[model samples]
Target: MKPQLANRVHTLTPSTTLAITAKAKDLKEQGIDVIGLGAGEPDYNTPQNILDAALKSMNEGKTKYTPAGGLPALKKAVIDKLQRDQELSYEPSEILVGIGAKHVLYTFFQVFLNELDEVIIPIPYWVSYPEQVKLAGGVPVYIEGTAKQQYKITAQQIKSAITDKTRAIILNSPSNPSGMIYSETELQEIALVCKEANIWIISDEIYEKLIYGDAQHVSIAQVSDDAKERTIIINGVSKSHSMTGWRIGYAAGNKQIIKAMTDLASHSTSNPATTSQYAAIEAYTGTQDAVEEMRAAFESRLEIIFPKVTAIPGFKVLKPQGAFYLLPDVSEAARMTGYVSVDAFVEAILTEANVAVIPGSGFGAPSTIRLSYATSLDLLEAAVARIDSFVRSKWQEDLL
Candidate 1:
């Protein structure tokens, strides 16, 4: 007889982004020409200064276990960053660093949730939020954010979702998939609701540095003192510094909660990689020129591709204020092509056109599809053209 796996393991959904990326990779390995728009990482290389720091750490024999939470220097860097960027203050004791922002979130859910306790997650969320909550024995309650609202949930929706079982709410601005940012006014209103309900607020600000236009990244903790006390700020250099492989991310909030997370890390994983932690220190403290350069590249790509994508027949897109993704509603295209679902349309494009884009079903927005413009502009243009051709061919066939 096969050994039984834990029941919790069966409940988790594999990441659709990774699955699609892997499929594209497999086709490419088989010598097929595939343009993969499914990856979430920036195509930019890590900055030279950060790379130098990692090498220096290794040369100086600094590649050992750090404190389970993080090195003191890195924690200080995080504290300084919060003060400088968000105008929010946190002591070293109130901070805990983990393998990555995703790991920090996983650790967060593990530490904060009790069985049957509920966390209110906004719809069209990053794919991991609900799975992590479920893995941590928490029930995930979802609130939908309509397209008309720029995919942001209003304070009243949050208030309405709250029940006796609701323990927390997850907020992601400059959000993944949609790339919509919450305004200061919106955040202040939501903060008021959360404060009144006495609920914990998990603010994932990993993409905080990638915002474009006049939109600014504001931390919920920055709204007020009461908000700060209840809000846990999750951030890292993976996105900002193009250091995804380095796996360094962190959380800053109430000292008790931070301590609890640190203790959990002590047993599960000792610390974030020591060399990577050193790299992160340099990333936070060094010249930010590379960060701006990458941001400029992404903004430029978005500017060039947004119009072309919208011009595709039966497609509509919202101009993203931050992050590097474009979520275009493809329901019209799907219907016109005779596909019953958006996923079928996505699969057809991948198989017929050799262009890979993730279906929005995983993001809780089934009418849309997500394409990451993190790659080169040329490739993004080619992918969109291929998609256009594929859709047009389908329409031509239907006409017959």
Candidate 2:
């Protein structure tokens, strides 16, 4: 008999961004000058101090396993970070350090959800949220946030979607594909709905440090004591410190939830790497100069590239207030270029224009495409130019 795979994974849709990136990589190996803007990470090297700290920990023989939740010293650093940045106080018992924010969130769902539970996930969500919930035997309920709404779901929308089966809502401000941050007023409204519904709030703040311009990041947990009591904050040093490979992310929340997540981790990953945990402690306790420098670079790129992107024939973009991605509605452009779907338009842009971009269908916004500004300004400019030329040429051909 043939080996059978689990039904949960069989229905899972693979990440479109990674698939596009892999196709771009294949083109690059063939010596095609394909410029990829699908990366969901910073292009900068890890800060020198963080690298040095990791090495220092190894030299000191701190390689042994620590507590499944985290090193006590690292937890202290995380606690201090929360107090300093968010003005929130937390004991070590309320913190759980895991491999990354992604893993931490996965562990959270595994421990918190039961079969047939419902999780309210805002549409155009990060690719993993729905998949993780399904793996935990939970159903994903989506609320659409149109481009006119800056891709943000409303509190009334949340209230309307609630059912007795609702277990939690996954909120990612400074959202992944859209790059939009919710205002403090908006967060308060959402908090009220969650409180009334008595559902948990899973606040993913991994991109907190990468905010740009006059935009501010206010965690929903900061809305009120009741909000904080029910919210679990998922954050990490990956985006903030260019430490993606180091794999250190932590969750701060109710002690009981933290304990359950930590217990699950003990049986699974055991704990995050000790060296990475030491590096994370340094990330929280050390200077944030590099974080600011990277934010500045991304902001500068956004200012330059946004105008160019909007100039592409039939492309419409909402100026992103935070994060490093630009989600542009290209439905009109696709039609003008004689393509039936944005996904097809995206493919033509890669193969013909030699520029890789993520189709928005994977993010539940089929008319749009996501481009990362997390590359060199030179490459960004060149890639935009290619797309502009390609779109115009196809548009002209269609008119003929």
Per-model C-alpha lDDT, please? 0.93, 0.93
lDDT of 1 at 98: 95
Which 10 consecutive residues of model 2 have the lowest summed lDDT? 391-400
Clashing pairs in 2: none
Candidate 2 lDDT tens digits, 223-319: 9999999999999999989989989999999999999999999999988999999999889999889999999999999999999999998899999
Compose the digit string of candidate 1's lDDT tens values, residues 219-295: 98999899999999999999999999999999999999999999999999988899999999999999999999999
Residue 106 lDDT in model 1?
Answer: 97
